[model samples]
Target chain A: MRAWESNIRKVVPYVPGEQPKGDRLIKLNTNENPYPPAPGVAEALKHMDIDRFRKYPDPTASDLVHALAEYYGVGDDQVFVGVGSDDVIAMSFLTFFNSEKPVLFPDVSYSFYKVWADLFAIPYETPALDANFCIHPEDYYRENGGVIFPNPNAPTGLLLSLEAVEDMIRHNQDVVVIVDEAYIDFGGKSALELIKKYENLLVVQTFSKSRSMAGMRIGFAIGHPDLIKALNDVKYSYNSYTMNMPSLILGTETVKDDVYFKETVQKIIDTREWSKTRLTELGFTFPDSMSNFIFASHNRVSAKELFEALKKQQIYVRYFDQPRLSNYLRISIGTREEMEALFAFLEKYLAQ
Target chain B: MRAWESNIRKVVPYVPGEQPKGDRLIKLNTNENPYPPAPGVAEALKHMDIDRFRKYPDPTASDLVHALAEYYGVGDDQVFVGVGSDDVIAMSFLTFFNSEKPVLFPDVSYSFYKVWADLFAIPYETPALDANFCIHPEDYYRENGGVIFPNPNAPTGLLLSLEAVEDMIRHNQDVVVIVDEAYIDFGGKSALELIKKYENLLVVQTFSKSRSMAGMRIGFAIGHPDLIKALNDVKYSYNSYTMNMPSLILGTETVKDDVYFKETVQKIIDTREWSKTRLTELGFTFPDSMSNFIFASHNRVSAKELFEALKKQQIYVRYFDQPRLSNYLRISIGTREEMEALFAFLEKYLAQ
Candidate 1:
């Protein structure tokens, strides 16, 4: 209808989770860390020399990549860093898929995959997840240019095991299989180790969730040298200085503080387990989750009604409008006190 | 030869200006601010509540857009903010130029323009600049889908007059014309006022130069509502959270402090004038620049030789390997003291 290209016009666009204003609510809509980043992150930021900002940040976040490589037990050449996991995924779409071949992903997976496909005019096929909302490796055996899926899938919070991931990669030898481990550190195993056997495997992770630096925007992918090179080429051709210096420093330091990372992730996993049991007692039916969030619903209480009730009680949670997810609420696991408040509010609201 | 998409496999990406590490050198290589940012900037950053970072930034950067719109005398809908001007330019390539038609730009202008064209696999033509290294409006009148050039263009620091810009817009009614005003606040007249009259015009600006927030990464574009919509479509489909919270805050405050901005611009202009007169007297053949940098060379001193000599004296300026620009060195205007240091070093180097 406008002067813009038809491909851009056709894009439905991905809508990110709402960021509500006001301090009146206990926010849990987006799956962000409930706790502050490691003390080292703030210390690193506080002492940053303002003069250094005058120079451009390193084009390739070299130090961050090296740190990531060390953490994941990979070579430095196997890593590619970007603004965030979203940027990494977008770059992957640009790098691996072209108009000639179709990219494959789960229909119920990250919504941005479809948006990127439409934006780049890349042909794509969305393989339907099984009836239990789990991706079957056999379903992705078709001739695809590439395959990508969130390890602990958003909105659902279900994780695929390492064996299942290996099966998909083994079946799709020609295509790149990207394991998006945005929330993997919370409970699941990363496919980073699988990269040694599968040349086309790219394991993507973010500091947003585990490191609790979402606002700082840092993410990276570890893969074979060739796969990393493809992503680097795409990134270089697009925007070279994607990650700023402060973010690189923060991310690098956060990765090195293994004590902080392990303690925080364990804390989230413990909270998630406790919350799941409590939700079960409240007559909620939800999938077993491996991420820092839980997806659940009850037949008696509508998802929208519960969301509104929580909002009224100063407790906020995410509710989707899509068909499969419309009746479910995706609640990000918060601190012990915050979860207690949520449970107390839910108990009162349900009794009423 | 790479395992990238065919378009990206052939991409010889643009190399950004050097951002050499360590504090030993007098850095004038990149046209960054010689002075530190507004005092409020660092203070604001220090006091930032790290807790607020858990939530995603406002995807639209609504408050920053509002402030920028107000400063530019336009509606919020007319503005589009991104990570930096580079991101804005990347989005523009997707939004404005279709692969069927060739985009046009000055041959000697910003190198990133061609890089974007190659990345997007869009056909492009480079119109030659005039003998004085200035953009000739008539040269862009050919049948093209879009045209872009930095006002007070980079490397050359030569500016096209506002009237000349209007002439190009008038002649090319059917194509998108992006006027990059990254250096306009330093001295050149802005084409922001022309956006209302010309539906195809998009004026891009950055907070990196005058505002001294290059490390923060914030840039924006102003245009008619429809053109802005096209850019938004592309941005939404690509990466939605391009601008982070700190950047939005830094950019908004920077624009709001009009007095600080004015004083900084005036000081830079004064220093540039003083430096230009000195260069002239010292037998340098420099372009009449409207930018924060000067383009100069001397018959007696080869640009490469001068560059090496300055390096030996622990000074840094940019030298290009491109044909026309090979003989010239682009020197960023620094503080009075820094300029004096540069002059002293130059005098000694030249005498030797």
Candidate 2:
């Protein structure tokens, strides 16, 4: 190692899902929305004057923030915008998880949670999920520096009820509680409704999953004004211009088209429901997920074998090699034709 | 105060130059490029497929990174891109400045350096600049965690000699030395050539000032492969997809047209030279600037009064209220016509 390497802040980075190049595959590993973004997004981008790009973007991102605040019926101060939910949550970890006590979250949750905690040198403890891959509210009731977990949680795609989410928040009122709602728009009710009541609660959502703008990189948090102010303080101190021009303009355009937003979400939900029935008939058992992805384990074939076989056919799905999760595969809900292709490949491979 | 507020990472955020709304105003505060970006940037955006935005942007920003590396004649592994240079330098600070010893820079350098230090809890000491607002190589010869200073330093626009920069880097070989070349394209030569000799040196540049893409938020750092890898690791840990799709694509296009890039830069340089003569004729004095902006203090009028007087007429320039900078006004070079309007206004105002 080099002498200067000794002072380097070493970190094991969170490996994102593979963005395989070329368009011949049924890409499903990353739980991205199968539909395009709101049509207004395309219209907005087409007419955007690139000349204005010579100037710096609005650092406050007021237009997008106001759009989100109006859509969610919160005050403008109650929202914070970032590159994505990853950026927003990472900033939250830095801003609110500064106490000496260990922050708490579910073991089976968005994997980035632990990475952010480690990167920031914040002590954290992951309480194991119950046998059914469900988060127990009582597990988070203990005293901690802060709390955070994804709703309609990743891999399992199971969601905690609003009351349970509130129960955890009420118990941990002394510390900040972040509800990562990346997958909330699929079917789950957002914890945003509870923000007015809980000063320490922050509900984060993204345009990546349901809004079909992952490539655009927009995410936001709706919380009490105090939490929002603190997040902004740290964000500005770090980088004043985190959200660029196109994102600010196009993200605002996204919020204006509620019809397209709802229709796209419903289509994914419909596809997911249809997929669950087909998976059950094929001898798969898994949680009844509310998110845009389904997690399943076949009755006979090992998930590893299935994962490799599917990869050979270019029908990609997420398979965690970690303990307990090795048996399951998380399949994102794609278009009907794409799902049919995946099912066709699976039926033939399993029979063999 | 709320009990949870104690855990909040409270910080005094850096205030950026005001981007006053309205096109009627002549904006010259932020040192942004005076011209639009390469024509290819518009062509690329016009043909972009918004449908592809449903997927996540490339986490590595490979196309843009490779393009930059090829353009700069560096290996692909030696390049790191981010939302802007602020994001790039912020990540560098997080990745490389983790030692217990205090990092060192000129006291009058980019104000954001101190803000990043405070935000990350990295101890830093700012040595005083010389009477001429120039960095002395010997002042940075002592022990510290790291060193960073802008070339053609901000709000002063005074360029340090390449030999002086190399001397400082040679002395601080034990720790990372960052030469922020934000305004390097305007006149000063980059320290990038020295990277082959010094593995500890990192050169950061931004398209915001020269390539005319501040709104698109494109910035990059070129250094040794190891340093680049360390920056990527910390960046991934912070936010996997810092550069969104449009920025990745548009930034790549901006790099392809070298002719347009050079012409735009030369235009700004010519304007700066012309403006300097005019400002001198009007009884303003400043360091010999090798940047897109000139930092000048009027002989008789107070900078605050001039700043306010200019703002009333819709011509904006930056004025610092802090000690030492209170008398100085940093005026960014705009188009020749815009500069003419500014001179027209100033000629009468100064005479009065």
Candidate 3:
């Protein structure tokens, strides 16, 4: 190893759910939407002026930002766009959490939080989630440099209520509070409504989920203009063209088609509800899920056994090997046909 | 304005040239390719499966990386792709220049270097270019944490010979030496040949200038497997899916068609050469430029005055208002008709 290598802070990165190659596998691991994006997105792609790529895309992505602002009913300056929610959150960590005190987050929330903190050498502490995999608003009331967590927490589709989120932000007024709503459109209300009440609140969301455009990598942040300005300062110092033209063009089209977005989201929510009842009858236990995925533990079969068994039959679901989550499986709500195939396998394997 | 704002290192970011909206003007501010990308790119965009965006893109970007490796005759592990060269160089700075020692670069080189240094808290020193705006290889022999400068440096377009570049890297063997080759294809040999011999050398290039894909935001860095590993480690920790699928798919098509790349680059070079002679005849003086853009100062008119005059006619070119560059204009070489129009305007204005 090179001597200079020591300068890099050691970090164990967060590994996302496996993206199975080819269409043979009934993939349901990463919470991708089961429906295609808005029809306008496809139409926009079809008629794209490919020659426009010869010039640089607008750094601010003004048209997309304006579309997002109009859709959300916020001021134009209140919105900020990036490559995806991952990028928006990473930039927020760099811009806001600079104090010597440790930042607070749920130990079982999105695992990328700690990775970013370690990468930037910022102090952070992950307070354990409650035994039921729910966030306790009181846990974040104490002093910290900043705070962040997914609303409908990953790997455990439990969402914190809007009132509880506001309580947490209200208590931590001195520091920035970033509420990641990557899955909010599935059911829960967004923290966007709370931004004006609390200046430090930043609500982060993405087109990767409800809008079904993860491959395009479009995400955004909504907050007070001052906070957006700070994020912009850091972003401009970093890569100015984080959002490419295709993402900006198609993302705007997707944002403008509210009817298609709502219809598709309602379908996923319905599918999630139906899957919850079927998994219960199959002897699985989980908190009531508010997201497109359900986090459940089989009453009889070990998660590892079920994970491997499904893989053998070309079905994919996320199984965590980490502590407190070893017995849990996060199953994304796929099309009705895909879910039916999953339960058919479960009925034979877990004869309980 | 805020108490925590003091923690962020204050920096004035590099402002890229304006991307004029509407097709009513002749655009050439940034050094973007003046021609459309290879025909394959348009074909790929036409046939792109918009429905494929339901899932996340491949994090590794295998196809594009392999294509780039094959084209450069390097192993796949020797290449690392990112959003753009700005991103590649920014990541390089964060990964390699972590030592307390100051890095070395030219004072009048790409202005983004200092902005990145300040943003990341890396100490850097800019040694003045020689009287003719040429990099003196001996100036880089001194001890520093790292070294990075464009081959044909920005705002000047004067190239340092490959031998001179090799000497600088050899002397600074302990530190990483990055050769920014954003304009190398216009008319300069690359430092890609030095990677196998020097493990610390990194050659950063972009499709923005050479391949006419600036709007897609594709750039790459080439080096030894060890250096690539270090960059990958930081990248995985930062954002795994840095390159979107459209870019990954379309960039591969561009790299495979080397003939189109050569034709477009040669066309720009010929236009640049002819433009240089005309500017010289009009009493404009500049070092011999081997890049797609020229850095020239006219004896008869102030650059700011000419910049406004050009803008009045909707002819755009980059004009820097910084120290020592206030009097110089960096004109991007556009199509033949566009350049002729520029000269036609200049001929009349200079006669005054």
Q: Pick by lDDT: which candidate is best?
A: 2
Q: After superposition, how far is residue B195 of candidate 3 from its true place, in Å?
A: 0.4
| TM-score of every candidate's chain A | 0.96, 0.99, 0.98
Runs of candidate 3 with Cα error greater than 4 angstroms are: A3-9, A13-16, B1-9
Clashing pairs in 3: none
DockQ of each: 0.50, 0.87, 0.66
lDDT by residue for model 2 (B1-352), tens: 8889989997996676698999799999998888998999999999999999999999999999999999999999999999899999999999999999999989998999999999999999999988888788899898899999999798788998899999999899899999999999989989999999999999999989899999998899999999999998888888899999999999999999999999888888998999999999999999999999999999999999999999999999998999899999999999999999999999899989
Ranking by TM-score: 2, 3, 1
Estimate, for each residue in B1-352, the C-alpha lDDT of model 3 and write its tens digit.
6654544445675565587887878887898888998999999999998888988999889999999999999999999999999999998988888878899999999888988898888999999997888889999889888899999899899988999999999898878889999999989999989898998899999999988999999999999997888888888888888888799999999998989989989999999999989998989998788898999899979999999999998999899888889998899999999999999999998787
At residue B284, candidate 2 shows an lDDT of: 96
Question: What are the per-residue Cα lDDT tens digits for candidate 1 across A1-352?
Answer: 4343332334565666677788767888878898888888778778776655555678878899999889888899999988788888888877777637788889987788889988888888988877678888898888777888899887688988899989988987777788999999988888888898888788899878888878777778999997788788778778777776677777788888899888988998999999999998888989889999999998599999999888887788998888888999999998988999998888877888
**Which lDDT tens digits does candidate 1 get at residues B124-236?**
99988878887888788777777888998887888888999899888876778899999999888899889889988899998778887777777899999888888887888
Tell me which residue pairs clash in candidate 2.
none
Error of 1 at B77 (Å): 1.7
Worst 10-residue stretch by lDDT in candidate 1 chain B?
A: B1-10
List the lowest-lDDT window of 10 residues for candidate 3 chain B: B1-10
Provide all candidates' interface root-mean-square deviations. 2.8, 0.9, 1.7
